[model samples]
Target: MSVSKQADIAPTLRPPPALPADGMVISANFSVGGFSKRWNHCHQLANFLARYASANEDDPERHATLLSTFFNELLEAIYRNHGATGEIKMRFRKKQNHILVEAEVPINEQSAKFYNHAVQLANQPDPMAWYREQLEHDVPDDDAQALGLLELAVVYGSKLSISEPTSGDWLLLAIQFPFTEVEEL
Candidate 1:
């Protein structure tokens, strides 16, 4: 007896699952390197800001404004001593509930050793003192200082650690923030 052969149908493929409704918390870390040369210093700072602008996904005008504000504050802090140059480039990655940012600061002849020294200071429990020392010369106004402190707390303060990666010339600033409900914000 010949049995009737029936074709088996294959199941359709399904798309990958989407991320949870909770939006991501983004972080950006930036730094400058090779600032020994007079012109390179300023260029580096400007470059870093430009990189920040480029990486931002939000409105260009808003991003530019944010960068400009940060740049002005940073410039006021270090212009006399470091004289910004080079570029500020940052790398970011998403963790469980937060994002990590790593920013690089160019090291010039005069600032090379200083940069390393700052890294050492960063290892301490309270690095705010070190950060303040770095900007003592600039003497930012009260409003500026308050804003700078707020930014530092919101951005870098959340970091659990800082390290020099084996693969790249970067001072890794790792931060994590919770993905909370809208009302929580």
Candidate 2:
């Protein structure tokens, strides 16, 4: 007689705050080696900041404000390090500030990494299966595609693929930009 051992599978982590039905996903693609390196570093920094902010829960608003400030400062540092001399093109939306930085030196490696990652994520299981299910259930293909793409961007930082359920036909191919920050609306 053989006994079967049970293995515990980790639960899939959902997006922090549930995404809205009509939420929109916006993306911008760039080609810069140094900028990509700095961007990846900034990404790690932002993750750390978020973890730190969540450590305490006395004042959620204060935590958000501090996190935003830290994000701005980190982006500035990354921009300056990449030789950005003039006024940086930074955009402030409702909850986040976005800075666009350009590099003087061409960064082929960074560009390739970003491009490849985007392509890989586009074909992942979660996005494809979820979208297919929605489409088969008669949800508007466009809406399902948009929502799936947005979720993929937030979760994996790049490409996503969706399919229609009934016909098992691929419907959407989406690539998303790496956003610096995301918060509840």
TM-score per candidate: 0.34, 0.23
User: What TM-score would you give candidate 2 relative to the actual structure?
Assistant: 0.23
Error of 2 at 139 (Å): 35
**lDDT string, candidate 2, 96-155, tens digits:** 222221212211333233323433544555655655566578766334324433344444
lDDT of each: 0.41, 0.36
Write candidate 1's Cα lDDT for 109-173 as tens digits.
44433333433444556666645654676644432433342344444444334455454333333
Please list the residue runs of candidate 2 whose C-alpha ends up more than 4 Å from where it truly belongs after superposition: 1-90, 95-109, 119-185
In terms of lDDT, the poorest run of 10 residues in model 1 is 174-183
Model 2 — which ten-residue stretch has the worst lDDT? Answer: 98-107
Clashes in predicted model 2: 3
